[model samples]
Target: MTQVNRPQPPVRIQSSRVAESIAADLRQRILRGTYPEGPLPKQDDLILEYGVSGPSLREALRILEAEGLITVRRGKVGGAYIHPPNWSSAAYALGLAMQGQSVRVHDLAMAIRELEPRCAESCAEREDRLETVVPALEKNIEASEDALGDGAHFTEVSRTFHDVFVDLAANQTLRLVVRSLVAVWTIQEQAWADAMEGEGRYPDIEQQKAVLKAHRAITRLVARGDRNKVGKIATEHLAATQPRVLQFCGDRTIDASSATAMRGFRGLK
Candidate 1:
């Protein structure tokens, strides 16, 4: 939202230091696709490659696992496997930062309100150069329309709409920073949507229709070189929607670890 642990050095446990260095090297290898066929080079092969003992290599793999760059499995069928780098990991990291600084969901929403309109302005300018951009937003709105009454499914797709808009805005900094906020907020909103299910907290069709109309209007305005209109409309749309959703949330702070736990993990196979 805003400006976003250690162990003691045990006496002469050189393997711990070894593990960190090994994790760094293997992280690069996985990222660079050195192990393309399989998610990992063989455990025995890694031991040989790194010239380390089995325990040391295992320790390195554990470090990588905690960093979310790899998954380590035990048993005969198990081995360390590379996990792809992704926004969720960055989002989790951002959540951790926000947690340390005592950031609230309200702060995050405010940041989005401030920054996303800038993204809208940027999106308007970029749409002129990239003809496909507006169509992409249009597709998202169509999908949202189709999901009008399905709270769970709509929760996921609606995020894609916001994420795609931020992405197409043609600003790398906003894409990374804003979308990290987006990624975490979506995780929270998924849980929020479920909590709101029976209580009828989700927008009714009329409200949904109004939102869809606004998005469609925003899309049209952005297409017509109306950067100011894009920013004004987007900000107002978000401002209007935010309080309604937060009204249901109360004072719950977003905990990234819990969100990931609740959603469960789906690592690359």
Candidate 2:
């Protein structure tokens, strides 16, 4: 067999304080559309703009590169380029931000379960207008085929299924909130998966099939405009995963005082 190189681990930021400030500035510019999807300023220019030294600027660039906000290259075309943040990227970033402010992983999961079924119920109401649900349901099934033996893949597909429902709901504000919540939860779930992978404690392969079956049943009810059954089945589908998430977070305690203290570190009250 041909030799394969090990993938390099992501570089760590030596100065989080500097990196975070730079990241905040860059994030604002991007959000404001000042830095559209195009080339970015030279390092020296950014150094002057942010009023930071070379090392601090480079460190910030490294952090943004890791966060998928900017791309750095070398030679004639070398410089950081603005990257348009997608829903997935936004979600992960939001997750990191929330976790930094002490939002627990399982608590995030509970929040999703609370919102998603209602979105599903909405999809059921306008099933004629929405076409994404059935295919998303199918994808959920195919994605779960080997979930018992592959936790990472399973988690990704599961995330997709939940995200699709959020999309199908057709509410821009709700979609934005869901993506923000998912982003924070994704990091926690990744951490959770690391410890739980292959412990033979995952939901069985058949259990996943049942969830998909429920999804399809809900789709059918939605197609028939049976909002009541849609609501009921959506509840059942989500309840399937809620208990496991609760169990995972059972031992992870959060003190309200600590939460309050952390809240002071966040942007909003």
Best by lDDT: 1
- Worst 10-residue lDDT window, candidate 2: 260-269
Candidate 1 residue lDDT tens string, 61-159: 888888888777789789877767766567768877776776777777888889877877888887353476688888899899899888767766665
**TM agreement with the true structure for every prediction:** 0.83, 0.62
Q: lDDT scores for all predictions?
A: 0.75, 0.65
lDDT of 2 by residue, 19-89 (tens): 78988888788878996689887789888888877888888788888877888899997888887776655
lDDT of 2 at 43: 86
Candidate that scores best on TM-score:
1
Q: 10, model 2: CA deviation in Å?
A: 38
lDDT of 2 at 244: 64
